[model samples]
Target: MSGDVTLLLQAWRSGDAGARDRLAALVLPELRLLAGRQFRGERAGHTLQPTALVNEAWLRLSGLERIDWQDRAHFVHVAARLMRGILVDHARRRDAAKRDGGQRITLTGLDVPAPEDGLDVMALDAALARLEQLDPDKARVVELRYFGGLGIDETAEALGCSPATVKRHWQAARAWLYDALSPG
Candidate 1:
């Protein structure tokens, strides 16, 4: 399975359309399963269903045919990024269609936490962008840790850093992001 996935990735990166489809077929089930873990706290009757989230993520991933698709960790990181984009885009669309314009996530049993200071998806994305500019590694630590569901060890391995460094960077990045996203 690993060899096949590697071949699919190589072929897809080499501009083979069939390889892209094969790559999607080979990787999407695991991707969906991983994505499911991130939303287990979602409320029962929430309109933002897990399937929609997974499908959106897959669609975005399937479109990344131009990159040099590397091994497992790289795949996971790109998937994480695409998934975050899907959620942010969905939030933006929901806000556009709603009577009250803002961003929020509805967790299980009905606790909807609004973004700090009416910060919508765009604001969050912009904050992430700024974070990326100031410290790309820290921003990526946040993405891999939170969105990719990677542990510190795994993130450190993916990032070619030590576990202790990953942990420190993760903590610092989260604090920075929270402050950056928070309303003054």
Candidate 2:
């Protein structure tokens, strides 16, 4: 099944419209599952539905013309990354609106424990950006495992590293993020 998805992705990369549609059909369910996992940790009353999130990510993905699709894991990783960007952008806009008397916004997930109350998405995103600068491999391990909802072996495959290495990075990254996000 993954081989088929990979082939379709490669075909899509080559600009085959039929392959794009077929690939969407093949991957939509998995994409929805990923989006659903992301939303499960979101604040109650958050406006975006899982399907909507999947659609938004799909739309953004459709616009990209340069990605070298390696396999199903790679494709899903890209989709997850796009969804993260969309959620982060939404959070920033919500924060901006709140400054003008709009409702406060909260974002959850990324497996960070609630800090006193809950995790702030914007702060996490900022800290992640800094982590990316400091140690890109560790940051990617966090992103793939936490945000992408990928398992240890899957993450190892995606990163082309040993599972032990991924586990080490995952543990270290979680600790670093926890400390960085902790109240000062």
Best by TM-score: 2
Model 1 misplaced regions, further than 4 Å: 1-4, 15-22, 43-45, 106-123
86-183, model 1: which lDDT tens digit per residue? 77877787778884664554222112234433335566667778989999999898788767778888898789899999988877876776677555
lDDT of 1 at 111: 24
Best by lDDT: 2
Q: After superposing candidate 2 on the true structure, give the runs of residues whose Cα lies further than 4 Å from its correct spot.
A: 100-117
The clash number for model 2 is: 0
Candidate 2 residue-wise lDDT, 1-184, digit = tens: 7799999999998889899999888888888887787666556787668898789889998888898999988987787678778777776777787763222223343345564334666777788899999999998887787667788998998889999999999888888887887767
At residue 166, give the lDDT of candidate 1.
Answer: 91
TM agreement with the true structure for every prediction: 0.77, 0.89
Error of 1 at 74 (Å): 1.8
